[model samples]
Target: MSTEERPPKRPRNDYGSSDASGPPALQRSTDYWFDDGNIILQVESTQFRLAKSVLAMHSSVFRDMFSLPLPQDEPLVDGCPVVILCGDRSEDWTHLLAAVFPLQLFRTRNPTLDQLSAILRLSKKYDIPLPRSDCVRRLKCEFPTTLAEHDQLDTGWMHIEIPGDLSITQALVHLVNLAREVGLFSILPLLLYDIIIAAEPGENDHDNPNVLHHALRKLSTADEIACLRFHVRLMQPYHQTPLKWIESVPCVECTAAPKCSVKIDLLLGLALNAPNALIHEFLTQWDSHDDWSSKVCEKCLIVAKAVHETARQKFWDRLPSFFELPEWEELRKMDFE
Candidate 1:
């Protein structure tokens, strides 16, 4: 099988084996938690967020100094840090607030193995000590999934370990929404494109076609199509939603033909029901995009069109001395018409 087709999650290596009980209680005093093959430095509530910010800035600085282009597929590789320092009993809580502000202030340096070991030791020693739920809860958000149900969690990370044909794509779809939820655009380009958490903000109270038109144009190639699995594909109309029972689809004969006559959309291969916005965006974007190809493989026409050379190169020339791509400056003035 192609590398692209491998299962999304590899075997969980939560510190050599799935001993869900975790390291012996005394080992909890170890400053870090090693699980799922990553060493995380623990930080108390105040320190964890600060550390995450510091890490992000540090990563960005490294990116600029290296002058590397964004990874075409995944976000720039991020090293696992020792867990952020969630406090323990010996660590004084009253004075710790001062430290929290400082830690949350910026992305932090990667903690050493010793630091991580210390955090893990705390977790093992006492189930709850300093920092309280508020602090840990915030730190926990950094991770996509929580450690609550799992054996050993890289609590400040997002991860999925699933096996399937399109697990990566499925993960991407989920990640995109997560990114948008946090207001980050283009985490990593859809180079390997396993998912798209396509979104259009706000509800459609009036069902305006102009709103639809604009949404159609937002049909960037980045949107994920998991939505199609929940809503019936355009061709085979089914009443999956309340509106489906009342709202008739437009022009059934020519434009509305469906793909894969099966009414149940198993393509997602996921148990999730697609949200309304995601479902609509996928259908609109997929069906109407200039990139839409009419062939067996469903390749997009974007590669042929993105570099509208005559138009693009002209813009590329007039930009600030150090610039790339077609410059927006000239293109705005030249009315292609």
Candidate 2:
């Protein structure tokens, strides 16, 4: 019998090979290509050379995977087994690895929103508890449940440096989407409120009714409808309670009732015309407006402040209801669970 010549045995030591039968040539990760690493993870067209021990130490999923025996035909690169990571973005892997091995010089700086989002997602996926817990803590600090924490917050609570091209509206929308995906419902009310206020139309918006804010357009239809509905319903309680002083005849002890009444009317007009009046914190003390204190009496100011405080607390208590969400306690419980 004539012996049939078999096809030449495929080479097993072809490093960086891109033959037709093999995977496409992968670009080595600029930040994660460790020369001595024992495992090669390929995400999309990018390859990250990393230590298996380091990955197994941090992630139980990786530890368990490494404990299993590999197939006889497993592929290798530079003698390290190649693991093809499917259904994950290379950008996310970059962020996760950066967090895992943060540079010493930038250790003090907070991660940008994009980095935080990626860490939160990948850490959860890999069951890396430390980074995931830290991310959640930072997120809770930014999107607090209590009104007191919200009032005390600085202009920018999260980032050390926001990208110049990314507006506050875009950031809020990104955060809202991330929060929804991560099941962080406790923070959704404040995030949604911020989105609504940031996307409120300007005076010239009426001239172009069809023009939508870019950030508002990004919102899911369900969220867009919920926010609009909440805004409409908010006006009634807002005017009747926190701004009820506007409709009052003035404090009975007013030294100049007529003049005080005129100032109140002016304020009422301003409130009615203000785009975010419904969501504005009525209890916010206006330090720069000395005219209000000089024009309006101490007794009237005190009364207005008291009414505003009570109404505002009640509003915060029911904030989740406006967005058709579970109560704050329930939402918080969901987070812990």
Candidate 3:
């Protein structure tokens, strides 16, 4: 009688169990639910039915997990034990599984940024060496330690061949976070410099719409601060070394002092007025306009190129320091290890 209106009894299912307390319904993955699979890997509401032996062969973590004795009352679907993968995304699992079981055996394919990222994360988590090593190798190819390899990159800094919907700016932001997550510190200086250059108002505006705003919103606060600091700290070396020719008088063997002096002044103006001057590779010869080579005397041109090369090498050597990273050799060692 004193039973106040019991909260409307929770709805019951066909089995007469309350819906609120019953197990959540799972959706079998369309691609990964194999008829002969021996294990169910559930992430959230989706389940992947895969071969335990295959997974164990590839991943030490999985091998060890499978070696453990299961409880007598362990949940089973289609006679296979269910292993819920906590703190993992179904999409990431799909990527890793797809890589594990390729449609064409040994056929090389370049993964999109999203696919690569998912594979990298999951492979690292499960201690799958092959995929992890391949991902690291690809990343190093894109963001190499040596300046020579870097110089070979004609496409701008975010040139990792991300083939999909992900824009360059988005890929850059993702790569910045991913590199840190995976301990690829060697690539950060160049990557951060690219981000800083992209965030500069004019450089990123027309080509990459809203890049500045996107980067500001997406980048970690520490990375943002690092970029700001690098921008400020780089100015002294940027001006003093790479662009130091701006302050110098013409060469002693001056063939045309007035003309060479005027050219140097013009070069100085261009360097100063550049939107991303702090990160600009001033030593790089502009293919479209070699004004220094065309306008300056041969002797002066030779001297300028030499000075720029030496200065830029010094700048490159010190690049990792700007971002508070270890030297290039140390960073490279970390990557290999």
Error of 3 at 136 (Å): 1.3
| Candidate order (lDDT) | 2, 3, 1
**Runs in model 1 lying further than 4 Å from the true structure:** 1-169, 187-337
Q: Please give the CA lDDT of all the candidate structures.
A: 0.30, 0.75, 0.74
Report the C-alpha lDDT of model 2 over 1-337, residue by residue, as the tens digit.
3346666655542347677977666688999999999999988878899999999999999999999999998867889999888988999999889888877755778778878888887777777877778788888888889878876777665642457788777888888888887777798888887776666666666665433345667788888788778767756644654556555437777766888888888777776776365455443444434655665767677765566667667777888898888898998987731
lDDT of 3 by residue, 235-280 (tens): 6544565766545448888788999898778777776666365455
**Per-structure clash totals for the candidates:** 54, 0, 0
Which candidate leads the pack in lDDT? 2
Candidate 1 residue lDDT tens string, 167-274: 333444444453333222323222111122222324543455243233323333334232332122322322332213111221123232244212113422221343
Say which prediction, candidate 1 or candidate 2, comes out ahead on TM-score: 2
> Who wins the TM-score comparison?
2
**TM-score, each model?**
0.19, 0.85, 0.84
